[model samples]
Target: MDITAVNALPYEDFVNIFGNVVEKCPIITAAVWSRRPFVSLNALEAAISEFIDDLPESGKEGILRCHPDLAGRDLHSGTLTRESREEQARAGMDALSSGEASRMSRLNEEYKTRFGFPFVICARMNDKANILRQLTERCGNERAVERERGIEEVKKICRLRLQGLVLCDAPNKL
Candidate 1:
């Protein structure tokens, strides 16, 4: 899954590898997949940023939909991934007290009701407290702002995940 291998993949194969996430963040995924043998992690990250920068508002919304709800503990098919679930577990979702679970449930409902989508965050490097804190703070953002922010968060997550999966930060050419 290094950059050379990733870039060598057929476009359809690349799309399939990411599953539904590709459709949600096409421009970013496409640019990343198309950029072969990235010499540095920064170069790959640049591609991602450029892709996000060029997306239309509607397309940005599509990208935002790729992320799971912040700290979502329960499995609901289509949403579970090994990496995400592992991160959730690391965040202590498995040991939530009943009261904490209730609060999270209510907060999730309120956020979704207000924003028209679930609250999204890049939980890759975050533990449970970080996720919970973000969920609480984000509840205060205006809908329009949160929508835009959600897309950015997804972009961040994709970059981190892609770095771990594909980029190698080598200086040699592919």
Candidate 2:
């Protein structure tokens, strides 16, 4: 779809389509819709960034909490949302061996216990080995550092997702 179409979308329709760009945070999309007549994809992305950056500490944590753990129960039970499932699959998380799966579960639980939110990474940009490595390494980070890392990953995910919905470089975009 074109940026023009995206700009013209009804609030409900816009939310329905782009709602999960930030994992389960549709409210971001809803809020960003108010900044419409976006000049380009970059403008829309910047709007999302501004909203997220303005969030209080608790709100940032809330966004991280909305993400399902990678290769977690949701993935095994087929309960992940379509976008999440596909992203996890891209990281080969959908086919983890029993040992690998169990290890992931244990580490995920540990990470959540420490951080009050699940570990999150741009799975589309990483394979299982890299994700596992990141999960372990990030667990050692300070709370503030980790929170910013997770939020940055969320932004990367959102950028890719938005790229899929609207033309990235279309001129005269609404």
TM-score per candidate: 0.74, 0.94
Best by TM-score: 2
Which candidate leads in lDDT? 2
lDDT per residue, candidate 2, 120-139, as tens digits? 99999999999988888988
- Candidate 2 ranges beyond 4 A from true positions: 168-174
How many clashing residue pairs, candidate 1?
1
Lowest summed lDDT window (length 10), candidate 1: 18-27
lDDT of 1 at 90: 64
For residues 1-174, what per-residue lDDT tens digits would candidate 1 score against the true structure? Answer: 455565567877776664334324554555567665566556666776677768787666666666566445444343666666665666676667778777877898889888777777766667667777788899999988988888777667666665555534543432
Estimate every model's Cα lDDT from 0 to 1: 0.65, 0.91
Positional deviation of residue 110's Cα in model 1 after best superposition, in angstroms = 0.7
